[model samples]
Target: MPRPRRQTGFAQVTPNLGEHLDREDLLAALRAPDARVENTTLSGLELAEVSADGTGFSNVAFRGCTFEWVDLSGCTFSDVLFSGCRFVRCEMGRSWLNHVDFHSCSAPGLSFAKGRFTGVSFEDCQLSYVDLSEATVDRLAASETNLMEATLHQTRLRHVSLDRCDLTRATFFRTSLEGIDLSSCEIAGIRVSSDLRELRGAIIDEGQAAELIGLLGVRIKEDE
Candidate 1:
C-alpha cells in the first residue's frame, strides 16, 4: 500500500484564474513557438486534429473538453485540472505532467509512452487501452478508474496508489510491481513476465492469488 504524495500549493495559483478562453484563443496559443498559458479555463471545446506539441500549461482548467486525434507530445503541464474531458486517439508521448488531476475523464487509446508524471491523480476516469510504456510515474493516485487492457510495459512507478481500479487484461510486461498493493484492484487476466518476477513484493488478496496461480500451471479443486 504505497502512500501517494499529494500536490501542495496548487490552490494558491489556481484560484486567481485570469479569464475564460475560447477555441480560437487556444489554437493561437498552441501555434506559438513556445506556447505557455496559465491561470485560465477552457471549457466545452470540441477540437480535432490539433497539434500542441511542446506547449506548456500551468494552473489551467479544462472542463468538458473533447480532443480527438490531437497531438500533445512533449507538452508540459503543471497544476492542471481536467474534468469531464474526453480524449480520442490523442498522442501524449514524452509529455511531462506535474500536480495534474483528472476527474470523470475518458481517454481510451491515448498514448503516454515515455512520459514523466509526478503528483498526478485520476478519479472516476476511463483509461482503457491507454499506453504508458516506458513511462516514469511518481506519486500517482488512481481511484475508481478503469484501466482495462492498458499497456504498462517497462513503466516505472513509485509511491503510486491504485484503489478499486479495473485493470482487467492489462499488460505489465517487464514492469516491476514491487511494494504495490493490488488487493482492491481487478487484475484478472493481466499479462506479466513469464518468470513472474514483476509480481515480487506485490500485495494481492486471496482471490487474486487464485487468479494468478493458473499462470504457474497450478489448478485448484473445489471441496465436495
Candidate 2:
C-alpha cells in the first residue's frame, strides 16, 4: 500500500518500520506511559514497532497515521480516537484498551490475543480475518463493520453489541458469549454450540438460525 501524504500535527518523528524508535523523544515531550493526551491531534507520524507494553495513553487522537506491521502488543489506551488510520497487518496482541473509538479504519488480520478491552467501539472499519482469541472484552460495540472470517477462540465477551456487522465465516471456538449481544450482526457460517446462550440477542439468517437451533434439542418441522 502507498504511504499517505504527510500532514502537520503534534507528533514526533521516529525511525522507519521494523526499526525500534527512541523512547527518549517521547519521554522528553512529557508523553508518559500514563499521560492523558486528550483532544490533541497526531498525523503523518510513522514509528517503528514499539515495545511499550503496559504504557498508558488516554484521550489521544490519531489521524491518517500509517502503522504498517507494528508490534504494539500489550499497550494500554483509553478514550483514544483513531480516524483514517491504516494498520495493515499490525500485531496488537494482548493490548489493554478502554473507551477507544475507531472510525473508517482498515485493520485486516490485526491480532488482539489475550487483550483486555472495555467500552471500545468500531464503526465503518474493515476487520477481515482479525484474531481476537482469548481477549477479555466489556461493553464492546461495533457498527457497520466488516468481520469476515475472524477468529474468537476462548475470548470472554461480556455486554458486547454488534450492530449491522458482517460475521461471515467467523469462528467462535471455545469462546464464551454469556452476555454478548449480536442482535444486528450477519451470522452466516458462524460456529457456536448449545451451551453458549449469548445467541439470544444474536441476529442470523434463516440458514444460520437453523444451525444454531440444531445445536439445541429443537427440530424444525418440514412440510409433509
How many Å off is the CA of 115 in candidate 2?
0.6
lDDT to native, each model: 0.88, 0.70
Best by the lDDT measure:
1
Tell me the tens digit of each residue's lDDT in model 2 across 114-156: 9988878888899999999989988787888899999998888
Q: Using TM-score as the measure, which candidate wins?
A: 1
lDDT of 1: 0.88
Give the deviation of candidate 1 from the true structure as CA RMSD. 3.1
Which pairs clash in the backbone of model 1? none
TM-score of each: 0.93, 0.73
- Candidate 2: C-alpha lDDT: 0.70
